[model samples]
Target: MGSFYVTTPIYYVNAEPHLGHAYTTIVGDALTRWHRLLGDDVTYLTGTDEHGLKIRQAADAAGTTPQEFCDRIAPAFQRAWERLDIANDDFIRTTEPRHHAAVRELLQRCYDAGDIELDTYSGKYCVACEEYYTDDELLDDGLCPIHKRPVDHFEEENYFFRLSRFQDRLLDWYAAHPGAIVPEFRANEALGLIRGGLRDFSVSRTSLDWGIPLPWDSDHVAYVWFDALTNYLSAVGFGDPAQDHTQRWPVDYHLIGKDIIRHHCVYWPAMLMSAGVELPKGWAVGGWLLVDGEKMAKSTGNVVNPLDLVDTVGVDGFRYYVLADTTYGSDGDFSYDGLVARYNADLANNLGNLMARVATVVAKKCDGVGPAPRADSPLADAAAAAVAGATTGWDAVSPSRALEATWGLIRATNAHLEANEPWKADPGAEVDAVMGDALEALRIIAVLTHPAVPGTAAQIWERLGMTGALDDQRIPDAVSWGGYPGGTDIVKGDPLFPRIAS
Candidate 1:
């Protein structure tokens, strides 16, 4: 089997999980599921970035040690993933011993390569951002543009990474890998930043006591980028240079938010070059999920608790809204009204209605046994086309496009059933042909759309009297024109997504 590795940015464990966090993890989960359907060997990784100044501050605010605070907050992320049906292969925490070892090794390699050197540094830093910012980057009154807070000035001795030296190399890599950064516009943004100029960034902090200590120089700890980025390699056995890390060395994709495009696209590749490592295969950047046209933030008191939505809408309903409503690489507004509308229109009205209608007709007209679909039916042809679209769309990481394409099959099936009116037609060969085709369409829809709306899809599969894991079925083939078997007992279930009145 071909190999595919994907990772979501390990979340910072300074706060409770929110809708933004859920949005990215769900995307990763859906992508992983799609790859599995294609019969590829996939390793999906996500976890908490537990060691940082932010975590330390959060711990101090809670009157606990950093480790104790991380121990508590990290589980919140794990539990949220479990509740949301995230299927990550591993969750690597930065504070874990394996991660520490990897960070030390990566730091030492860059230092030994003459790219890391001791330097006296002085700058205006944003505690919220955990990075220094130039005067041009600051807003009026020298505040952080993102946090809208005043910046702090400090002078200290630190170790700096020679990022400026690799600007030409990064430009060359991007030139060779045109599609390395996604959303074309974002790629342009990264290129523009590189063209503007490059600066050597400090890689060690003497002022922070809550991070991984620099290997050769014990007085300092590795900074955020150096410490956090190492989690990707650490999880894949990077510290054990004796072992071949080639299997997982070149990550297929790094799914990150647009806010950190500079860190991932610019700084990361430069760091890899310094250490003589292969760059990531690609970077898939997604925009923020805004609430009421404002970014979700704790200070704004606008952060939506993802668990509350999951409880109300159900996991699959929540997942479907996240993937379908938002076009990849664009900001999506979240509201209770919007969520309810989508759940009702797409889930309850379109997909759920199709399943219930098919099963009801089979039970009433076909004596509760689903007849095998006719090979030459028009419904089968339409389903085949929809399945093909879904396969291609998902392969491109366009989840919204994939779901829209899959829903075309749903719409076609609804139209076919309405046109034939199998329930109204007399019980005969023609009626069986129509109902049979509809059942087959349901089967195809179940397999093809399972990645987006898994819980409801699996339920529909069971109601149609199908056996085996729906997830195990291959894409396109499972939804192909002629795979539905005949003469199976049809079981009708309650409305999969009951509509909520507005």
Candidate 2:
């Protein structure tokens, strides 16, 4: 089997998990699930960035040590992912000994390569961002562009990475690897940062005690960004001599939010180049899930706890809405009304409606045993079209378009049932043909939509009395028309997604 490795940015452990975090993780999980469907050997990694100044401060305020604080808060993310049904292969923390070794080895490589040097620097720094910003980069109010808060001035003696030297190299790398960053515009944005100017960034901090210490300099700790970014390498056994890291080195995709574009796109590649490590194959940058036209944050008091909505809309309903409503690369405005509308229209009305109608009709007309579909079924062309569009969309990381294509088949099947009025027929061949086509359509849908809504898709599969685990179903062959060999007992159980009252 071919190999596919993907990672979600290890989340900062300063806050509890929220919808913004959920959005990115769910997208990664969906993409990995799609890879599994294609019969690829897939590895999905996600975890917490547990060591940083923010963590120390947050821990101090909570009357705990940094490690204790991380231990307490990191599980919140694990639990949240579990509740949302995320199937990540490993969750690496920056504070782990494995991560520490990886960070040190990377630092030593760059240091020995003459890329890291001691330097004295003074700059305006945003503690919230944990990075320095130039005067021109700041907002009109002399505040951070991201946090909209005043930055503190810091001058210190530290070690810096020769990022300035990699401008030409990074440009050449991007030129060689076209479409390394998704949403072509974001790739251009990275190119702009490199073309505009390159500055050597500080890699070690003298004042931060809550981070991985530099191996060369016992007086300093590795920058949080550097420490956090290496989780990708460490989880794959980058620094462990016992493990063969090359099996999954050079991740297929480093899924991240657009806010950290500079770090992942610019700083990350430069560090890898300096350490003589292979650059990531690709980066999928996603826009923020905004609330009332602003980024969701604890400071804004607009953070939507994903668990709070789980009770209202079932997990699959929530998952379907996020993947179907947002275009994946664009900023999505999250509103209660929008959420309810998407859940109602897509889940409650479209997919759930299709499954219920097919099973009910088969039970009433075909004596509860699904009839075999025709090789020349009317939905054959529609199913083929859907599989084509969905394959393209998922390949391009466009979940909304992929799901839209899948839903098109649902809409078409519903129309086919309506046009034929299979229920009105007297259990005849005509009714059998139409109902059989609908059943076949549903089976194809279960495979197509499994990545986005696995739980709901499995339920549909079980209700159809298909033998074996739904997860065992592979793509292409499984999705082809006429795979649903009918004659299985069809269970018209409870509504898959009951409509939520507006």
Best of the candidates, lDDT: 2
Encode model 2's per-residue lDDT on 77-106: one tens digit a residue. 999999999999999988899999999999
After superposition, the stretches of candidate 2 with alpha carbons farther than 4 Å from their true spots are none
**Top of the candidates by TM-score:** 2
- Number of backbone collisions per candidate, in order? 1, 0
Model 1 lDDT per residue over 1-502, tens place = 5888999999999999999999999998998888888888899999999877888899999999999999999999999999999989999999998899889888888998999999999999998889899999999788998989999997999999998898889899999999887777888989998998999999988888999999998899999988998888888988876666678779988999999898999989988888878899988889999999999988889999999998888999999999999987888999999999999998899888888888888888889898888878988668767877887777777789889988999999999988888878877788889888888989888887788888888888888888888888886467678787988898877888888887
Q: Which stretches of candidate 1 lie over 4 Å from their true place?
A: 241-243
lDDT of every predicted structure (CA atoms): 0.88, 0.92
List pairs with backbone clashes in candidate 2.
none
